[model samples]
Target chain A: MSDNPQNKVKIEARDVQVFYGEAQALHGIDLDLNANEVTALIGPSGCGKSTFLRCINRMNDVIDGCRVAGTITIDGQDVYSPEIDVVELRARVGMVFQKPNPFPKSIYDNVAYGPRIHGLAQSREQLDHIVESSLKRAGLWAEVRDRLSASGTSLSGGQQQRLCIARAIAVSPDVVLMDEPCSALDPIATAVIEELMEELRKDYTIVIVTHSMQQAARISQRTAYFHLGNVVEHGATQQIFTNPKNQQTEAYISGKIG
Target chain B: MTEPSNPSARKAQLAKRYRAERRFRAYGIAAISTAGLILFFLMGSILLSSLPAFTQHYVTLDIDITERHVDTQDLANSDWRALARNALRAQFPEVSGRKEKRALGKLLSIGSSDDVRDYVTANPSSLGTSIRLPLTLSDDIDLLLKGVIDRDLPENERVVSNQDLAWLDRLLDEDRISRQFATRIFTNGDSREPELAGLRGALVGSLWTLLVTLLASFPLGVMAAIYLEEIAPKNRLTQIIEVNINNLAAVPSIVFGLLGLAVFINFFGMPRSAPLVGGLVLALMTLPRIIIPTRAAFAAIPPSIREAAMGVGASRLQVIMHHVLPLAMPGILTGTIIGLAQAAGETAPLLMIGMMAFIVDLPTDVTAKATVLPAQIYMWANNPERAFMARTSAGIVVLLSLLLMVNATAIYFRKRFEKRW
Candidate 1:
């Protein structure tokens, strides 16, 4: 892998802390995600890896009594400032969840929802192109082209997940976050999602939280290992897996401890 | 593992479990049959009492219209009162005294001469002809025919005098009186005459009132539910509102009647007996009925849907408007229909707002004076007329049918969308 200095930082988080009521979930953390790169966060259960991923898109703001204290910037623009419109920020940064949840409407409507709300496509032909290309990029167009009017929930678990990915990218967001996107899928379906992620990294910056170490090694350019609300190691995937600096990272890779 | 090794004990345990299941099934069947039996009893009683109201008895009479009975120059303006009394007297030649003649007149309906006048106006050329007309029998004779007033009772306590009862018996023996199915009960509107009263006014008023209730409550209730359950912060204010909604559903419906009398009739200056005012008042009462269940339905949806929509860059409001609403639609519609059924049967509120009026014509518009089914039935039940008893029962029958139709529609939507979504 080439370490190019020309690669601009897409997201920067410094000393990030998250709390739910009186209980703190995430300790102070510093990490930078590069453009056109896939960064994977991996840890055991209750390690706050998913919580950190949620902070990037501000999805946790909907929860009552939950607070986040940190400076999170996207392309040097402050994401937490009062001047920032949360709705527009969300349109710029999209997400995919672990369970495949498609709207109870037609597949075309599911993909067109974001674009229609934001007035992204001026004409029907433009919206048609956006939907088709988004599905094609997600590796679901060829299978679903004949039945574009079918309900998205009618598809299989894997197809629904891909449809969600297509739905997320329909508005052309610069950053996409996935929270254990393949955890609910079978091994074969997991393989298909991993393959799709490989192609998506060329255009949009992706941040994924996964429990499977093999998935982190297979697709990510950079990996961060979390242990009990703290990130213990961060570097290239190859270097971290083969020759890590911390004993916890080494023991985690060797299966001595979670 | 040790328990399975003991075969005798295991067999006994299985037998006991199967026996318990059988007992539970029997209890369920017993409960359902009890409910069905009560419903059958209620419907059967109402039908029995209401059937007689749709038929009436008539007596045929013949009388020669003399020159004095008709003003031939302006024949169309002639009244039937003098002719009808002469016709009754001509049938019974022995009645000569004034008091006895008046008692004889009581055997015929107060509305009988009006019927004779209709016939004369239709055929005005035969002014001096002798016509045999079937006239409506009065309530005394009607009760006598139905055996409701006992002939064995002393004349002083009965609805008819001894001579009048004997005359009615003679008319029955001669086969001059006949029973015919009453059509005016279906064609005419509310009236002081019980035999001519109909349910058309109340039926149409309920139709319009329900339309207004649906228009004002459905969208407003569903939207309010969405806001409270999905968007509004769960703080003390919302909690207080939630508790009050629950209390509203349980509050004496008369409280809403008072509210309507205060807000809609007095404060708003709306027409007192108009369906428009009645509908607005019912909508206020029905709002809480629908909103509580709608919020429960929204709450029943899995949280994964909200999470999924949010993940796709949808705002909180968008998540509810686009995703949550479509899924919970069938439940919301069913709740709205149940609330409407409750509103259709609401009497106290309507009575408070002056819907208890004797309306003789179908209300042509929302602003016109109107009466609802329950209020109309209540008025008829309180009337002293024996004929109105059957009419009141018939109104109940019609009201039940309307409620059934609305509930059936709710079932249709429930079946259509419950599983599809």
Candidate 2:
């Protein structure tokens, strides 16, 4: 693939190893995430794709007996350094989940929670503006604009997933990590999320871990194929899919192996 | 496994399975109805036994409050009993002997003087005027009037003797005998006389004790539960603590009473029979009960909510306070109220802490020596007096009503705030 000025590294991860108790889940993974681009990690179950995505925002810290050892940096600053405040780090690098988890609160409050906690808005009008723009960017404003006071859970599955997206971007984070954000959604809902991601990539760095190879092919500029806790191939999405690659990557894309 | 090759055999097997299912359903109905029947019988008996205690027999007489008997300056020390005795003697002029006169005097309660005093105190202008005052009947005469003593029994077997019966009949014929609501049972405090014994002291003590229990246990229990569920690491120490908590919930309540007696009373020198000490002991007993269910309520919340909050840059405390705690609140409140209800009905620990004492005054504060409802009921049940039997049942009814109200509040809150995740 030809290089462009837009392809600047936003996140640099090197020799990242993850473990649950004594069982290692990821073995020395190296990946570079570009600014303003969607990077998709595609692999079978237990392939360490989701684990690697969580390394960016330190979401795994809450889990017991889970540990990560390596260097993960955003804009050349180490995320795992003792100086990094987790709360602030998370605000800088937000995350969306596999299932739609909206707080049992009004749609407006759900979207405004991020900004309120981080003191991003000085006035109610500014907070409202953030909620509106975030919802619009996620393509849910038209459906939910009139009923922002209604509970976010009252929406349909697809709309709820969109609401979660809006909530994540409400804080204006630099990077958004989504872990199989479409797994619990239907295909139509999944397509809406994919399109939303495509639009989101223009402003924020996006990293998604998905089981769907087609989703990786359609939405991502760079794709990494993982198997058995190891990355088998990493390149431009088109080359990884269409051109010759490693034997394992070939077998996986051909549906002969996972 | 042998496969049924014929449709008829398969149909027969299906019929057999249906019959088994019907039998199982019948067994379930039988079990539930059995429980319902027992509960109905228990409540019915308590209500029936308490019915007579709700009303009392009083004899109204026109007694002249002369200026000579009542010292206008010192009404508190006035000889009001003399007035009641003279009024009774005037009603029965035919009886002249001392033995017969003493027997007639037993018809009125010993506290009848207080009744006259209270009336005179309220109506100071009525001095030197004839006012009709209703005097409380003694417990024996009351039981006789209510037909609980069986008047037809032989003179020796009956509590109301022949002379007492004649005077009571004379009073009844003259329209002096009136059955009124037993307001004294709720108005006055505990007494040696069953008719004068009231539940006010016990009620106040129970309220104070439960207030302390709730204030002491609820926040502590909830915080301990949160720490164990969300903050504590899963290791041998926590595992031991969890196991002990479960074991504490099953320990005999008397053990908690002994601990209170030793620690709060003997070591700390806290007042015995005080609601504060009783409440603290009960709080200790109820802590495990509250914590166990609270932990369960918290555990029932989905992990996704916590993750959602943390993903949005919420701190650990923020994740629990904003998302997990609200979702788990209904369960926590229900557990806490149920534990409190159990604590309200608990008697063993209180008895051990000296709350079974015969307290005559309403507890003024948590530190005052007082007796709770269950302790009062236990003491009344042990009394040999016949009227005390009815009082015990009445006390049980009050305690049961309180428990029902608390449980209803639990249900109401659970229904009101519960959210489907």
Candidate 3:
């Protein structure tokens, strides 16, 4: 709605409906995520924001009896098309979970897992370089540089989450999806991740589903408020938080209803 | 309901809870001790009864294998029993009747002929000279020496006659009759005489059978479990298959034996009483056992680990091979080894496959006619001879030890490789 020519749509979703078995979870969602910017989706618990985030990389396909019906495109390619290889699609679109889920392996191997599986490096030195740069980008290189041989789970909570981020970006995906990456961290750790997100938006398109509105307003350029599986408000983050057009969005933002 | 804001009421409630906890602990201790007592009695009786089988009586004789009696050119055809009988007659010069001489010959085991032949064949130079050698005693005399057959029993009630007893007493006084460890129980194969019966044949048979069962069931069970747990969709067909697998585990083991007899022996023309057929039967019996636990092991793995791998662009097969398998390996191995242990102790199914036959020669390969440990124990237990009772108990001890070893290996693998997420 801003009519800015410089904002390019990196992923576009139209009328996306999701169903788990016989129970419908999301109904007809429409949203656009722009290139080199962060889009924040804020909703109450069980409001389908995480489900929508999982749709971009086809993560929902792995769940038994879970179906997503709609056209979701990344750079004009339909992700649900018959010819689309889900492995390649996921390689181009990475995801991080709510908890810090690093493989029970050495820290270097955890970050190199993606690159190795995707064949992104030609030699061990190239893989080492990829792991180093990814960790550096996630701001975890300084804390874990000397302990790459240690298990990823042996790290502190915030550091482990950053290691997961480094792992997600090691294959150099164009889009990164984060589902409440800071929910399990303390305020200081959350702040570190929020700062990392602001820096990550310079190179990768990011979509985050957060429960905290303040987290959305602090790091995201675009904001969408979801209620009962519907997008109630969508616009520039400043405009959506300050001057929302919808009464439900205002009620949620003002703590009147969730 | 007893808790209250008042301090005295809260204190009473806490005391009651503590008392209940202590009572529960007492019950647990009592249950464990009862189990321990039962195990102690069971093992004590088996060990006590088996002790007599460990030692055997041998009658040593100074016999001359003369050149005339033993044709050195025809060692295999030489009448070694006649030479032993002649030496025994030489011992009792005053007793000269044919029946008395036959009774005197009965003191030594029939197998002593084979032993003399074997010695003479090995040491040809000692044929003409007199050599002292230990000869195996007959089972009845062996039992008498071991106090299994009561020496005080009346003449008709006991298998050992007065004349035989007199000869045994004289030999004992002369230090010619001796009791030593029964090395033959470990070295020889099955025989009608209890003194000559050993577990070597049955032990080898069990080894071959378990090898076949492991090779047949483990991979098949694991592959089936992986398919059912990870890949197969939850539908009517898979649900039916799951129910059938559970039912298969509950089917009487004898039914699997019958199936093996019919399908493998009758239809496929596999050898009857072969370890190969017995192993195939046991494999069928243990398959559902392995699959159930393998599936449970797979189910215990957190789905998050799988999703994490998938998020990094791993294919479904790669996710299982790289992450899920390593995490579940300890559980899988424990389940498989426990299944094998159960199969090792199984007897009814092997009986249906004719493994209860009286096998004498050690099975050289899987397809040879053979019997397992439990089958051998069963055969010995069914024999009416008093000497067989101790052998039966000894066979049970050996079987129990092997089972213990297998179960211990299962526990060792579980503790050595178990991983925490």
Candidate 4:
């Protein structure tokens, strides 16, 4: 550990509440994501973990009747501010969905989509280099490099997910949010992605939502447990797994309550 | 595992079940064959009855184009009529030998020289050219040639006299009588006489009307569907719009014609029988059909694709233009083609707007008086001549071919744009 206070917090959420029409989905919740570390949010279905992840990038804005309230800031800039452009904000905070959603395009175009949209790479050569390096970093280049023109959907399920990851990283975002990125994959593909995430954390702050506690322990440096729309506890992965915490957190980690 | 039983009883039960199965299969086969038989009968009847209309018989004459016969320069002493009579006598010596030369001249329609006079006067450049004009054969002669008028019938009962029949047979034996495919049916204008009728005017009118309908309906339908499916809030107003669109699709086509009459022709004072007014009416009828299917296609797209596009920094408009619209293209095209086919087949609404009138010249513009294919067929079917029956069948064939072409185009585009994902 660097033990440096300068790398203290990258993202801060204070008393965030979300609603779908008249029903409340998330209660007021406070959390902080540290810089250059992987934080995993673990919870059961309908526990609002994915909802919280979506709010960070304003993905919930597309849903009809969905309203999010509270303050979320990235690097001291208010993400929920009226002046913030959602498109620019999303370009900064990229996301990978739960299911593998490789666009109905060639593998090369899938990764190039983000960079092309954000104007991150100026020329074709720069875009090609970005796609190659991003795919390499996602550990998908070896399997997919020869067939870049083939449809992204023609790949195996695991490769499609990695392609999505590569697409998210190609824009060179500050934070990468993954919503159960490995839930759709087998154990072999899951291990490959976990290794890729370990390498990715060196430059980008990563937040992952997963149902597997073992995965949370293996990949993430910090862990936050959510229950009934509230963050029950959060600490270092080792401390949260092995040491004292709230009873709900203990019960959830021990598999007594999801 | 099998339960032990008396062999004969088991055999009887099996036989009963087999009998029921055989009965069901027989019923299915009978139903299918019945449908096939009905379709074949309908198609065969149409093709068989309409074949004779394709040919028309004409009498060819070698009339010399003498300058004195066509020129009427002397105002007080004009004698082109005497000159035409002399020219007819010179061409057909049999007319001069007949005691009733006047009746023979009427039967041959020698007055058709008036048509030639008008043509030559209008186009003086063709004064020296010998044009083989195909004059309209009289309906009685056409029936006699086609054997629709029986010689066995008494003189008063039969439309053609025995003398006329004998003369027609001699003309046929001399090889002067010839039948050619009726090109005039496609080139000339509508007429009360089936022998002179053609679809040229009606076809032109339909083309103009369809052009207007396509221009006014397609974009408007697509825009309405997009707003309803993609952008509009799900409120009572949206629900009402949805219901109205569906209801409009089921509204009788003639109701739209009434609406058009009351609105466009009466209130707005647009020219009656003009293609513009007819097109507006048909467009109103077709809009709901196109919009409903387009909306359904837009709705079938997965919400995830839209979310992914938006998440990747695409604007709402960009998401729709780049993804949703392309995905929904096949359905939209199908809907449009079906709407066009329905519009092409519609007749009752056009009837209300005066599209059934006998327009003798091709429509010069959208504002010109016009008829359509179905209206033309309807008018021909009601004509007194038996020859029009064949003409009506030919018109049906043309209409069917047009519909087939439209459907084939729709299928081709649907296949081209179909996406597995």
TM-score of chain A of each: 0.97, 0.97, 0.97, 0.97
TM-score of each: 0.88, 0.98, 0.94, 0.88
Task: For residue B45, give model 4's deviation from the true position in Å.
Answer: 1.7
State the lDDT of candidate 3 residue by residue for B327-389, as single tens digits: 889889999999999998999999888999898999999999999999999999999888899
Per-model clash counts, in order, read: 0, 0, 0, 0
What does candidate 2's lDDT look like per residue over A1-258, in tens digits?
Answer: 222456899999999999999999999998888998888898888999999999899998988899999899999999999999999999988899999999989999999999999999999999999999999999999999999999999999999999999999999999999999999999999999999999998889999998888888899988889887888888888888888389888888878877
Kindly report which residue pairs in candidate 1 clash with one another: none
Residues forming the 10-long window of minimal summed lDDT in candidate 3 chain B: B83-92
Candidate 3 chain A: worst-modelled 10 consecutive residues by lDDT: A1-10
Top-TM-score candidate index: 2
Candidates 1 and 4 compared: the better one by lDDT is 1
Residue B303 accuracy (lDDT) in model 2: 86
Residue-level error in angstroms, candidate 2, position A109: 0.8
- Name the runs in model 4 displaced over 4 angstroms: A1-7, B1-33, B71-92, B96-99, B102-136, B147-157
Model 3's CAPRI class is medium
How do all the candidates rank in terms of lDDT, highest first? 2, 3, 1, 4
lDDT of 3 at A111: 95
For model 1, residues B54-107, the per-residue Cα lDDT tens digits are: 787888888566678777676656657678878877778999899999988877
- For each candidate, C-alpha RMSD in Å? 3.6, 1.4, 2.4, 4.2
Candidate 1 segments whose C-alpha is farther than 4 A from its true place: A2-6, A254-256, B1-5, B59-107, B113-135, B143-180, B204-220, B262-277, B357-369, B416-421
Candidate 1 chain B, run of 10 with poorest lDDT: B72-81
